[model samples]
Target: MAGYATRVKADIARWREAGLIDPATAEALTRDVAANERASLSFGSILAMMAALLFGAAILIFVAANWEAIPRLARVVALFAVIAAGYVGGAVMKTRDHAAIGEALWIVAAAAFGGSIALIGQIYHLSGDEASALVTWCAGAALAAVALRSNPLTVAAVGIADAWLFLKGFDFFGRAEFLHFFIVMAIVLFAVSFWTRSQASRHLIILSVLFYLVLLVGDYDTLRIAVPLLIGSALLFAAAVFAGDPIDRILQLGGRLPLHALLGFLTGIAMIQFELADESTYASGFAVASIVALSGIVAAIMLAGRESRGLRWLAYAGFAFELAIIYSVTLQSMLDTAGFFLAAALLLGILALVIIRVEKRMRAAAHTGAAA
Candidate 1:
């Protein structure tokens, strides 16, 4: 939004100079953009948020250190008091128009709610796993995010949701049942992100889902999972390319939907390649994966690179990663690898030429359409 505001302001200046818009109209437009654009967090706000977190951590540590000496009733009262103070203080700050500081305080209060849940449960000798406790904590954070309409709180809630999923076990494999719960929580967080306009939270949720997909393939290591992932990722990438605006409208993620979809597509390709390598067809499988990854990168550059620098950079990173993996996988056969790279390079060179021609035609067509 900050970037958008800057661009709009620049355009307004250009229009004023060209006499397309009067100076008065341009000034009004600039003021409107400034009024409506989402403000970025200042350095002070960042420090305040960090300070709140540190203070909350210190209070929690102090209380825990003297837990046995403190009366149980006093402990409960103290925890509730902390939570109330944070919320009430945040409300006051918000009323005074210190929104960033208010949101930071709200985050502190939400963190305190989670801590209180854990501390109270421990004090009462409640029976439950860490995952269950995290689930409760996540629920509290999520509720706070929705009620306060705080992007920072929404991000915190998303992090708690991820933490809940991670608490399942160290195995990082097949928890099909828990994955269902994780998906539900992710959906809730994603929806809350829309309400809070938290693009960061949405990114976290999507990345978490991608991580879960990786885990699924890692655990299953079969065609059933790998094939579906590949097909699904491809379809998703296609939709992101062709229907990006609609997806943006629905997801409200600006221009990042396609970038994320490209990542998921590459991940699916990697998953399939791993399956093939495990099946003892390493050379052929790795070659196919390289081609697919290279093609995806090229397509992204040709299709969306003009609009999204992030997407282009992600493609570049994917290309480097693909090269590194291929080199490592073929380390034992360096001679064969040399020849293979020559052949692959020639193939890709030809593909690049075709893509260049196609992109030129695409630009010409777009220019013609705009002129019309």
Candidate 2:
């Protein structure tokens, strides 16, 4: 708040000078600036959180120390007591408007629920699928997150739930391990993202969806994993590229899927590695490999790297690596190495020239439109 105060004040003064908003409206908006002055957590709140976490850990240690001496019923009572105390403390803090403490307590309660699940499962000698315990634990945490509107709890729940679903995806190869459950979790994560408007939750949900797409290859032959992933990423990239009123008018879905840009960018890089790693052969194996490498580099540079510098550099690296592989494997003469570098330099020069021309045309068009 202190850092941004001058800029905030300047912006408010500009708005006032421009007569974009009334004085009362400006004051109304600046109320949040006043709140920001107190946004830093006080020492007492920070100390309280640390002590609470240490105390919880101490109780867990005590449980392990006296596991045999404590009766089974007493052990259960103690576990539930910890949960009850956390929630009660959180509620009290919430009522008193010390939301930092309340949020921390909610996180503690949610974490303790995981321990309770494991302990209860062990105590009852639960014989059915071990996945049920994880799923149940996830559901409990998600319920708490939704009910309390806690962003941290929501993110934790999504992560834990995805872990459980991923385990299932690996454990069961048949239709039983289909990604439907992960899909459901993605939907739930999206709802939580919208409800809480947390950017972290949205990113987590997108990562889950990306991972789910990767998981789809578990059932396929090991040789062809990249095909579907690249296709899916291309679809996402296309959707993001063509977003807005036209697509919405046709599909009745509003707004862009901004996450697609990042997901597609990363998937493009992954596809390059997988395509290079594949040792499979075809009729024209060398030609096929060359085309795949070239296409991957071009696609990444032109589309995926349009917004991300990392992806652009990764594409350049991939192109150089492809040349190294070709030189080391197919043509291993000093002359061949020299030729490879020359060819690479020429290719890059051509690409740069094309891009420069395109940028110049775009700028000229922008100027023309402004004049019109």
Candidate 3:
């Protein structure tokens, strides 16, 4: 939203200079955009968040250093006191219109809540594993995020949840139940993201889901998991593209969902290619993988290149990687290598020509419509 406001203001300036609008209208538009722009983390807010984290860490360390000297009851009182102070201070700051500082303080409170969970568990010799602790911490962070609608806290919750899943990567084969719990947690986090409007949390959720799929492939039948992953990612990317406007209306994610989906799609493609390379069906798999990779990159560029710079860059990287893989896989035979490159060059050249013509026609149509 901040980027959008900045671009809108720049366009307004250009329009004013081009005599497309009067100075008064330009000023009014700029003011309206600025007024309506959503609040984003400024440099100070980021620094405040960092400082709050450090402060929370320091307090935890201090208590740990003096754990033996501090009585159990005092320790409990002190923990609650810090938590109360943080929330109270945050409320006061928000009432005073210091929203950035308020959010930082709220984050501090959330951190304290997590720390208290651990310290209290230790003090009482509570019976639980690291996974359970992480779940508890994530739940605390998520509650604070919901209560305050805090993006930072929501991000913290998702981060904690992903950390739990990452740890489970080491031992997920036996704990099949973890998959069900993880899916439920992911769904809850996704729901909380919509409530908090946390884009970072949404990105983390997508990445975590992909990570879980990778873990499944590592533990189970690779072909079964990889094939479904590829199909699912493709479907997800298609939906994100074709139904983008409606999704954005509901999720308010600013078209970022498609980029994340594309990442998953590319990852799935890479995974499948590796699996195929390990099998006896190498030749057919290579051909199919090359075609899919190249076509996916070209389609991405043609669909979203102008509107999304990130998508364009991702496509470029994917194209380079695809070519490199093709060269490496066919390195044994010089003829195969040369033929592959030649074919790829010809096909891409044809795609380039088609894309150029399509873009030209679209631009001409847009101009005609505007002129009318």
Off by over 4 Å in 2: 1-66, 165-180, 222-225, 244-345, 364-372
Candidate with better TM-score, 1 vs 3: 3
lDDT of 2 by residue, 47-91 (tens): 766766676566556544547777879888878887887888897
Best by TM-score: 3
The 10-residue segment of model 2 with minimum total lDDT is 250-259
Error of 1 at 45 (Å): 0.9
Can you rank all candidates by lDDT, best first?
A: 3, 1, 2
- As a whole number from 0 to 100, the lDDT of residue 250 in candidate 2 is 42
Cα lDDT of model 3 by residue, 93-168, tens digit: 9899998898888878877887788788888999987678889989988998898888888998998888888877
- Record all residue pairs in model 3 with backbone atoms less than 3 Å apart, i.e. clashing: none
Clashes in model 2: which pairs?
Answer: none
lDDT of 1: 0.80
How big is the positional error of residue 228 in model 2, measured in Å on the Cα after superposition?
A: 2.8
lDDT of each: 0.80, 0.66, 0.82
Clashing pairs in 1: none
